[model samples]
Target: MNSETTNPKHGALPPWNVDELPAPLPFSLRNALRTIGPGAILLVGAIGMGEWIAGPLFVVQHGRSVLWIATLAFVLQSLLNLEAVRYTLYTGEPVLTGFMRMRPGSKVWGFFYALAGFAQLGMPAAAAGCAGVAFAMLQGRAPTDGDASMVTWITVAIVLVSAVVLASGKKVERLLERLSWMMILFIFSFLLWVNFTFVPLKDWISTSAGFLSFGSIPENVDFVMLAVFAALAGSGGIGNLAIANWFRDKGFGMASKTGNMGGVWSTEQTLAPVGRVFPINAENLKRWRDWWRYAIIDQSGLWMLGCIVGMFLMTNLAASLFQPGMQVSGVAAGVFQAAEMRKLWEGFWYLALMNGFWILFSTTLTNVDVLARVVADMAWAGGAVPKKMPVGRLYGLLLLGFTVIACFGAFLGDAKLLLMILGATAAPITAFSALQILRLNTTLLPPELRPPLWRKIALVLTALFYGAISVAMFHQIFSR
Candidate 1:
């Protein structure tokens, strides 16, 4: 593709660039392990916010019974994630771009989702969570009013540093994949050691039962907290949608033909504003089946499986360590857990805090990428912005703006309030996108490529579940 082809005439949008499908790498446990990445990234991002902070907080307050909410959300989101990736496998575009390709055109959906994505993830809650952990590590105690200014500055620095690290990478997606794997290994290893060494078998059994303990709600329960936990128990809102962006960049399925977003300073690759869709044929269909199998393993085996284990382990540790009916919430909740670990051994305290730091920091870094990637793709594809501009350049600008906004947002409240705001805002967006994904996949893809009946039903249920959560959240807010 020439510069002329890459750059559309001033205001004109480029047409969809159609192409033949490339054969997927054969599906095998080995091949799938090598091929899989997006799910790992998603899993790392999913680990911190809900599993570390929200999940344990809920268990501490409500006991393990309500964990069924997280279980259900995880199952639904796995299906939601696979369905979103389904669109990208057929058309080498992020699912958000597919949303732009829907009725009412790009301008309407693009503007709406751009705002929605920001609204959903704009809070630097994860960074704020990191700041609290960092401050505790430094000061040898949790932060308080006198330490507010220091914590706020630390939050800003964390956000700024995330921006620099993201720019330093060769490709945004590749950088995230490497970082996620490293963090996952260290964080999970530390978590497992702590759980096994400190947490007892009976507690683990009790927590496991809590997940299957459906419809167990204590009286005067905080509906708001439960709603937030449910939303974030997996990847939460836009995080689920962002999986498709990572999948596209990973060159899965049709995306193998369409180029991905390059690094901020990279000029080597050029991504088409519109994605290419392959024809429906026997060869393409065969490749599609193989791709579908890989997708299943990526989501179910890696992403969902990781979420289940991560949530279970984190909650079990909290249940065993923290006293039931104790009040704990937000970023401070993690600090509280670290403080408890100190009772077992002083060294365990530092390890626990550092583990908390990595979990939250990884999410903060990934959120930075997701916010920029989704908006940049939407604007570039929508033609709302200059289509000729490199997506990397646009992405860089958005990254700067998102960082600045998050810095200011750090002072708005403590990490807990900010995360609650994050989850509350995210719930509606998740619900809306669920239905859009159902529509987009059903209408845009060929008949043979559309999601089957069971998948379609899951999508509907996902939308309805989140929709109900949104309504309940608002009522809980106003009624209070």
Candidate 2:
């Protein structure tokens, strides 16, 4: 029998090796850290699309008041992400790995994963195609005669870029960090630009809500505005789960399982200093000081949650600048007309805007690629897919196919419709992912590491939030 001392209820504690205790914590001088590596890229990539695109776009369309709603969603999603990361880091396992322990044959779990694969291929393709179009728009050139041609050009770009990128390997972790910082700088610069060019916050928010919404004023609220809020609130925090997985892969996995037969338990209490190849806690304490803490820092969630917070600010900024009378589409993205708005901050920076598009859409391309990889990985796990199958390569190809479909949709000027379709289609998946994560923790984890009472509260909240959003979307999608 294992002899380590541990909290029987929480599985194993972390930050410690199963060996004996070590010397006191060392004080080392470390440089300011950078958000590089998988964590950085994942966060930036997510913010590029989820926040920079989805969140701000919503702000532009809906009034700034919607900021409150989106902010709340970010908080909720962050909590979920943190929880997942904390556990995975402790277990040295992916959240999905735990799902295997959930009584085996859950067709329900398997089915959604399969469906998610399909969606993954499509989403990245679409995002890449959109980015391509944005790129083309910058040069004042159209690749094809119409939108369809434009999408094709974009799809080709995404494929080429991904191929080139994947072929040459700089560590993705470092690459992601650089990209995120660049994006952050860009956003900050844009904020500065907007502050100088636009009206003051007070002036913008004073505008009439003729069709916008407030808690009590039903008279001014429009369905479109409501839809915008719902979508941003629901979809914005998606990256958190990924964050949890990444951190789990970091060092949190072996956390709870480290007890020994010895009498005096030597436990570790903190993270290792940077530049250390491996974390150096020498004792295998059964329970962590903040044992469940890693659940919060997954790759997908870390930057995304922060970005959403940024976006909430953006929405508020816009509301303060041009609320009561502007359509989101018209404000940030009007055609280059010689109107008063075009002369000021409202005027589009075809260059910066186009670059933003590239950054934004490439993530989609990446997203599609990620999804395909995930799907292929899922199949590979089944033992049904051939061991020799180039699943990763196959997934890349699948992404290309999705790009084609997305370009076709974009060409038809139906991108909004596509967004709506994708959003609605993924809602059930989102809900399932949330529920699965929560359930996996509860049912599969050794009771010691299972989610605590507060997490149970969070799980309930996530369910209702997702369920309510899903029901509302279902009504709209099939309503017509």
Candidate 3:
């Protein structure tokens, strides 16, 4: 018998190359946070659209009560992220690869997921938003119709620079993780200073209460904006899927045995085409539990809590600075806030713009990396390209292609419209992936490693939640 047949539960796919799971890092709050990497990358990629622009816009227009949606979105998406990671932990392959392990196989699911990822992230909205901030910083105002060319070129520059950064790392995940930590520290430190100095205590209490006041959605709420808010509120769409890829690259769990995407000109890629599974003995089970605990803390504490804090701070600042019904939208959300803060101290305007620039730029950089990495990964796993080509070279080619596409896509519309389309597209994709992840975890995994009943329920609810958002959004679109 093959090694995998030693256990009857291993029949879901091709036989796994059996191996022992490595011991997990020591579990303390500080050690756990320091050792974890993927969540930081995920958090930085997430904060720009929802926290900075969409969530704040909703609060400024409707009220802080609308933040309940952000809270719920974060909770659901966190579960989705954890489940995605669960696959990577076992198989040493990305969750997208895990989706390919389902019945129809890699060829079919690969094409569908590649299409889905492109649809969700194709437009370089965050880069455009970053350019808008740069324009205000340079020209002392927001872009208008006359300045479209200038903004487009600025966005192109940002995309190109992101490619360069993505190429610089020894392992792409480490570079992203380091950048994420630095940016998070600066972003939070500045935001905390702004909040403590300017925002009133009562506004803080109200915003905190708003998150728990479930079902407080305003009657006249802009469902379109709400859709965008829900999607971007966490690592919505393909960003959530990419979390597994990052986990694999970061050498989490069994992924330590797999190869990761490397810098340009790195060694030949040797990632396992199929995942390796461990025998379900007591020792492996204990190690599995330790790894699972670390994953929970990484996802829940750093990613989920960070997203919540980001939404809360951004919305609270908006609620404090802007008037209700202010018509703040798009890049103007940041512009208006800076304008208001300038009245207090002129430097606040400049600082606010810089902060927005970092927030949006981080997302743009990570989005560019995510699109290129995922498409390359799918192509590699599905044998769509020559197996001999290095994965990094494939990623480099795709990154170049996406940069060109994003430059053209930037001219498709203004930042807000582009971001809205991006988020809205992600809702359906997230829903579809949630269902696939549920299936992958329950069926492909051994009973020992499969998620418990509670996790399964959460995954079902996650799919339904985003599914409803998708339906509501399409209904709004067609009815109009």
Candidate 4:
């Protein structure tokens, strides 16, 4: 057995490693796509709710001028994500765990991280509630008067079913992975087809230019626009941190050595031991290089591509289909437009409604799962939970707690407002996570494992970019 030291002060475990770990396969398009699982999961969690609701909501109001911001956000987030995974690859610990290791230690930062996480508790609730709106609409309960009784009931039903699915066992990850891909294929393809078939060539051209242009926000920008911008910028919010855990669970790089937290029904209680650092050597260096290459492909190909494409398509569809001065409200706005589009083409309405519902519900599922995982990781890393208590039990408790919060929000009956409030709250958390990840990558890793000078510069800019947006969002909120 390997001898290891545990830092009693901060609950820090010894560095984790395993002999004979899985090596990344040779680089190829096929191989890259095969490694698409984590990033794809990130994509679904990121774009599912925001693109459907905020993308169109913004485009309908501002005419795609703000899309450039969304694109820029994706680019910056990709870098932040790359840096985050780097620490995980080297350490076999979640990125947030790295944050816990910062100056004052896990206990101090874990409190702040947990506090930030509470702000995001509204996200999954808002997502499930939006999906409930779509479900209500599908059942012919028009939200013309903003009555959400049907939506409330449907949201509760979705949360309950999702809880059951999660608690079903250790197989939840695989099940969610498969379900995410199916949703992506069906929803993305349908949106692309609809936009191409219905949206005019000139509108598409104009919107494409808008996406590339750094156009001005309308002088009349309101709380709605600020909220939309915040939502688009952060996209995935605190849940993005979950990407590192997903990478670990997928057995990427060093994470393979650190066993993953089991699913909701798992009875395993004790956390896996954190491995020790591999002594710098030619073989280990080569392994790091191979893992870095794999990380780039996975981050660029899936996370960046999925978010950018999904946002662009959704925005374009909104700009093409809805004229200025039209009232656009959250998921209902998209679903109703699809209903209108169906009048033009038979069988189109179902596709639109399905896409809308799938996006929101899928996000709800992933958000709940990701939050549970993150919190559980924090609990274990911080030594807050007793070793005798099973991880699955903690995960289940948190998941159920979030679902209950969501049910309460659903009954409150304002999906759009609820989502906006949640989105605004997410902006600062995004900035915090980005900044923390940058610090961890720069200071924690060995000089050889640290990102190069150019990436270091880019990471700084990424953190600042998020910081500026977050500050501006708060300014807007307070000024209002």
Candidate 5:
């Protein structure tokens, strides 16, 4: 067969001529460094204002002992993220999709995912709102009443972020990844600097420095406590899974590559003018499965897992730094604001904390949309929505519309008040977790990838962590 006669076509390659190929051994060191991808970007998209504010605040308040709490929180939160990966890898189902696959006869299981997409409608807007406020704060232009409302600034910031994301397409990822790396560097820099510069580091870091025991609490009860916990750990909180599931649903998760059915490309020695021809046989074909492979190759893929832990530690840090007794919302919103815009620009450092807000809330803008999509996906899969409509898109539209209405409602009524006054917002998730555990136990996952014994043990441990937090929250609330 002549090489000139056979050109490339379809998924099939030309016959593998071993004699025509060159021997492999020429990878440049510089070329090898260029292959990273979107994992870090995803982390940046998620680990925002929360870390900058909460993590730093905790460090300031709790002293160095805050490290223990931050570490534990990271581990616990990361385990859930790990579950997100595990659930999505082989099956390609995200949290909402997983909810759809729940047991048929289970008690009230369907409701576990009914409103999953509610966040989609407003998350982007909410995130933008926060980012704008943070951005203003960072720029030393913290909004005061008549100068410029927080709402307007947030709206503008969100629009800008969205425009950037939309315009950049794939390129936005590279920028995001770079920024997230910077955030990590910032955290480490502070950690290192604090470790060295602070004089009390040795004395404070000792074993005698202990956690507040239950007995340390005054033997008192407060009724409003449970609601605080409910607010903290509500349905919209476990967003790690919601966003991750989105990436999975988008085909970023592990996939088993079906074997190549065409002629294989083989390497071999070749003559000068004429390229050689080789055999076309079953042996030449290759089959490859891409399951769990995303973990290795995709840069933006697994990086979110690490960031989730970072954010969790950040939460603990915040709590440690600024627990109730030490401060109660008195952190001035306009600490260094000048009436003039010129002064704001002159004080660039004022905007340092703005990135923190940008980090969490910027990504939150699109998150609710993904959540809405997830809910729709689950709804369609469960037959709650008509098949003709393609539930995901239909529900996404509905969720979007509803969010618009909700935002309007925010003007009419107190959005924050409306959000908390509703219910034990986490009930849907608690239900889902229970069902997920049961499903895992009853052989839902493949045997080989079924959670190991330690993971199984961790299920209870994780649940207890949540429970303990809940109880502690209630105790604190009622005692107050």
Candidate 6:
């Protein structure tokens, strides 16, 4: 393969040298494991409050019949996420940056995208708030009744600590990448162990059937059902778009050529151009094919696998431990679930409780960083910010601003309400992203690099699936 490197003199730091036709290393399962960073980070951000809080809430109330939603949603989101990574691999641009370059004007789309993102500001705040509640419960305090001020203060403290960690140095991304894998190995594994050990065989069989069988939504749908459906259909919220930035930062495939944004404390920053198109050729095509295979292993093995397993295990746990019509709310769902486990094994409750706390706290950290990176990227790409503005400064500003906003949201102290609001706003954006990916793959990408007919059809169906959910959600809102 012919390799071409370019070191353009621009920005505060040296530009990343572009490596056209950079050869992909020979793929192996072992190498795949070593390269699994970005997707695991995505999983860490994706699982968060939605999978743990909203997902289990649905199963606990609505039964395993709703798990089909999670299964179908996972398949659709996998397709969507893979396609987003495809754009990043070819053009060395983040997905939102690519979306900004689409259509009449990048600025116009960026505006709407930013607005959609703003609506999701409540997510991290809500998650941090839930984490505080979980932490309080572990300390023998009632999350709902005892020491209300303690939960609020704990929530604020979590957000502040996350910001400090993110701003610590340029190594923030690597730290989070490692942290995500550790959570997967320990916290996630513990949850799965509890599910298998406690969940009855009958509940397991029923949940499996619910996953495999095409189940119908009950005629009488409520706001809770709508919220869970939207949240479980994809990663929690706007955080899904941030995966492209994570992949770029991790130097995955062609993204290695692009300049990465520095951490909040970094002195120098580089703003990579969004639409720096590369020409297609035989050598480039070969490299693209190899990179595509690498992308599959990165996403399928880590991101999708973690989300599917985590969601399934949590849902089964909820279904087995709680009866239908039980009025569980917020982080309390986890507390109650853990308390139930105490009956089976000594000290199991503490394990479950700690796992629950980590789930929310880790997700809070990931969400804060992802949101800051994505917003900074969007602003820079769309020319909303001055060219000379340091990426790290913008990232810190956005991170702190969002954290402040989230503290107010935490004061509301209702995790389910916050999730419902986030879900409703996210549905349309999810559909928009799916549609944009389809458009980009077909119109912008070269024929050789374009998705195959089957894949294109799947993208179309994915768009329609989310579109239908969005429409139904809006209709429900209006009718009520």
Q: Estimate each model's TM-score.
A: 0.95, 0.70, 0.96, 0.91, 0.59, 0.91
Off by over 4 Å in 5: 1-42, 57-67, 105-110, 116-139, 144-237, 250-354, 384-399, 402-406, 409-438, 474-480
Predicted candidate 6 versus true structure: per-residue lDDT over 345-390, tens digit per residue: 7577677777777777777888778767787888887777886787
Question: Which number leads on lDDT?
Answer: 1
Q: Between which residue pairs do clashes occur in model 3? A: none
Candidate 2 displacement at residue 379 in angstroms: 3.0
| Candidate 5: clashing residue pairs, number | 32
Over 15-86, each residue of candidate 4 has an lDDT whose tens digit, in order, gives: 344354356777678886776577777777777557777667776876777678787777777887888888
In model 1, which runs have C-alpha deviations exceeding 4 angstroms?
Answer: 1-15, 329-331
Better candidate number, 2 or 6, judged by lDDT: 6
Range of the 10 consecutive residues with the lowest summed lDDT in candidate 4: 1-10
Candidate 4 segments exceeding 4 Å error: 1-22, 123-133, 136-138, 269-271, 330-334
TM value for model 4: 0.91
Cα RMSD to native, each candidate?
4.2, 8.7, 2.0, 3.4, 12.4, 4.1
Give, for candidate 3, the lowest lDDT window spanning 10 residues: 3-12
The lDDT-based order of candidates, best leading, equals: 1, 3, 6, 4, 2, 5
Which window of ten consecutive residues has the lowest lDDT sum in model 2? 269-278
The parts of candidate 2 lying over 4 Å away from their true place are 1-39, 103-108, 124-129, 132-148, 170-174, 196-199, 203-240, 248-282, 285-305, 320-342, 345-348, 386-413
lDDT measured at residue 419 in model 2 versus the true structure, 0 to 100 = 47
Model 5, span 282-311: residue lDDT tens: 221110112234333332234534444444
Give lDDT tens digits, candidate 2, residues 1-480: 122233112221122233322221122212113211345555544544445545545555554545555545555665666566544544444444344335444244444565654553354434533544464455453333344444545555655565445433332223334555676566557655554455565644533231134343234444433443443443332333444433422233352232111101112212121101112232323334332322223223445455554454444445554434554321112121112233454335454355456455546534543444444333433443554444334444544565455445444333344444444554455555667678766753444445779877886677676667677656755775
TM-score, cand. 6: 0.91
Question: Model 1 over residues 331-440: C-alpha lDDT tens digits?
Answer: 47558789888887999878999999999999999888899999988877877577667788888899999989998988887788888887887778878889999998
Instruction: Give the candidates in order of TM-score, highest first.
Output: 3, 1, 4, 6, 2, 5
